[model samples]
Target: MTARWWQKGVIYQIYPRSFQDMDGDGIGDLKGIARRLDYLAELGIDAIWISPIYPSPMADFGYDVADYRGIDPRFGTLADFDALLAAAHARGMKLLLDFVPNHSSDQHPWFIESRASRTNPKRDWYIWRDAAPGGGPPNNWISDFGGSAWQWDEATGQYYYHAFLKEQPDLNWRNPDLRAAMMDVLRFWLDRGVDGFRIDVLWHMVKAADFPDNPPNPDYRPSMGEMHSLLQLHSTDQPEIHDIAAEMRRLADCYGDRVLIGEIYLPLDRLMHYYGREQAGVHLPFNFQLIEAPWNARGLAQMIAAYEAALPPGGWPNWVLGNHDRPRIAARLGEAQARVATMLLLTLRGTPTLYYGDELGIGHVEIAADRVQDPRELREPGLGLGRDPVRTPMPWDESPNAGFTTGTPWLPLNPDWPMRNVARQAGEPGSPLMLHRRLLALRRTHAALSIGDIRLIDTEGDMLAYERHADGERLLVALNLGHDPQRFVPPRWARGACLLLSTIDDPVAGDGEALMFRPDEGMILAPQDNS
Candidate 1:
């Protein structure tokens, strides 16, 4: 199998609205990102994946796209996006746009026309059906936000399906015309030099034709949200979805070297199938295990092994630690563990994605009652589902608004931004930012860290250890996931390997022979030619 750029390179995700703000409308824009391309390039990332910047109503922020081919005014114009794309390419980095094909905003022209009348030409563009005989939702499908997924339309006397917020209605991908239009949307960006796309809700593109009610989830818990009350057996991961992905994959192949990545949240067995019947679907299905996995040695080791064992032949793997929707790593696993997580993420066998500001060890910021902005929290307050805390603006310097904007930011800055800002952390030799820079730099120079063969090493205590070797270069990554001091003994063959890097600034971190792991420490040992 050929090694693609996406397979070896690191991807950095930038939530456009939180990265930087040039116009100072208290929102981030395309030109703002273009201006900071140098900073990202310096961070040693090979690509940048900007979240949706398409025309939207700000209902789901930029996810509820009103126009697929145009940029939102708040995020600047098409010309600005082109400039940003050029800027990224000039710096030898790839740029990936977010594609939300599963749904469109209620305000979108297609949805507008579809809702105008039942007999309209565009009526079939979205999912619509007659109400149930009892005059409620057609079935028991629940919205991802809350309540019923079906919304009654007074004029049409029918109900429309929305997997998420009512304002973001789900599209009917089974429609031939609708699929064609979406394919055109893909071409429009490909023609403009987009490297690829990180498609949202890829598995939700198709639904069971019969529209059978999903069975109740036997393990549903209140904390898991009301949407989990019923298993999504009928609504998601339908078999036909893979066929649509194959079509998209074929189209992408026309633009050589272009890759397609899907945003799928499923179990290891189900998630691996997104690679398609013969690995012809999306280039990468986005392994989010790292984002949701528990921070424990045995569990994490098992997850890595299970995922590795489940990959389809010729299918590459990718890992994600944090994103716009999930809580920051430092907040969930503590600052010390976040460092270890970073090492784990970059040293893994395949591509890794880094969320912006994570390099500076930015954790979740508290959202006050008055400062709450996430729609999920607003609809179902106190569910702890609000993502605003993790989506705060990036802290650049110690100046006002953390140098994010001249005007008041859309979200509050972290109170400790003065100490955690990029400018401050960048200069700290032992800061998390430096750790990221060092790790990324190491990945570039060491093939073992990127595309090599991996062997899981069993350990005695709360330690996760693995060896990655290819050619004559070999490396061992050992991590202490617990608070107690744990020791790791490398295989007898690694007699000459010494410590290459440590998570903390320690002058005496151990070698491969008899490694002593301090609480919350992770280290890499190198070059055992004996293997």
Candidate 2:
């Protein structure tokens, strides 16, 4: 297999608005990230995936892009972004930008022009449809933020479609002109030295052309989220999206070694399609089973097996345990169980994505409704509590505002920062952050973990065991997920293995048969040399 930098390297995700606030404007900006490039380098990440920072109305935070080519005034200027790119490269880390092409803020020039008159030159740039016979939205589609997905325009006497918020209208991918315009936007950034892109809501790019009414999901409950009430069967994950992805992949390849990671939230079977039949689509289709599935060895193993089986031959795998959109992994898995999840994520046969603040074992920071700034929260009065908890500013120091900013941060810092801050954790030898650094170093040094074939090893309950082999070498990993000690049945291949890394201190030698594990412990063993 040919070596690809992305396949063997770790990527860190930075939600720019929450990473660091240099101006003390209560929000993080490009300069803050540039200042911290060394810190990320020290963490041993090869790339950093930054969320959207384009000009926006801030309707969905930065996801609602008003101008794809311009930097938001709130995020500084294009020069600041260029400086950030230089700093990241200097530290040996590539920058992967977020591409929010599925939709644009209603304030965008294209949307404005399209909505100006019914027969504007750019009328087809965005999805526009006539109202129902009763003068309501043409379909029963719902916005992800809340309410109807369509808003009637007084000037056109028609409703423009928005999959997210009224301020963010869905782009018309079916329009070749719009697609070409988006491609030009891609070239503009690729020319500016962005290493790659994390395409947002990739599956939502192409909607069913016929606009067929989505069937109602039998399992759907309004409590699941207003958006989930309507089945998205035909409206999302359209087959035609593969053609667009192929085009994107070709564009990225033109830049040589740049990658396109897709944010696809479909089942494993469908998610694999993002890789395309000819391996001409997304280089990495974000694997979300770990985030959505129940926390159990059996369930996780099943998901791993399913994903492995579905991957296109020669297509690489990627894993995401947590992100700004989901609760922290540590909080979802019990405080003690978080380490087990981390072990699995790092040791799995894929490019693992580390979410900022996750290495510090930070849990979701509870933000009161009055303090919540997410548009989803504002639009819905307590529908699923919104994503503000996961989007809180990074806790750096125990000082006021967790040292994230000199002034108050845009969002409140987690109240538990005194104990959870990086300052406190960095001081501890066995801190979660420290553990991450060590694990990353191990992956960097050991080809077995960094680039190896994964094989499951059968063992007993509350524990998951696997082996990674590359060349002629084998590395064994055993994770005990419970608080109690468990016995280890020596597999034929690992009977005489020597312990290399362990969460808990051990005497190096195990007398076969059984091994005692203390709480959330994990062990990596290398074959013993009997020379």
Q: Pull out the clashing pairs in model 2.
A: none
Least lDDT summed over 10 consecutive residues: which range in candidate 1? 507-516
TM-score of each: 0.98, 0.97
Q: What does candidate 1's lDDT look like per residue over 328-400, in tens digits?
A: 9998888999999999999998889999988988887999989999989998888888999889999999989
Candidate number achieving the greatest lDDT relative to the actual structure = 1
RMSD of 1: 1.3
- List candidate 2 segments past 4 Å from native: 505-511
List where candidate 1 sits over 4 angstroms from the true fold: 509-513, 528-531
Worst 10 residues of 2 by lDDT: 504-513
Candidate with top TM-score is 1
Q: Candidates' lDDT values, in order? A: 0.90, 0.86
lDDT of 1 at 399: 89
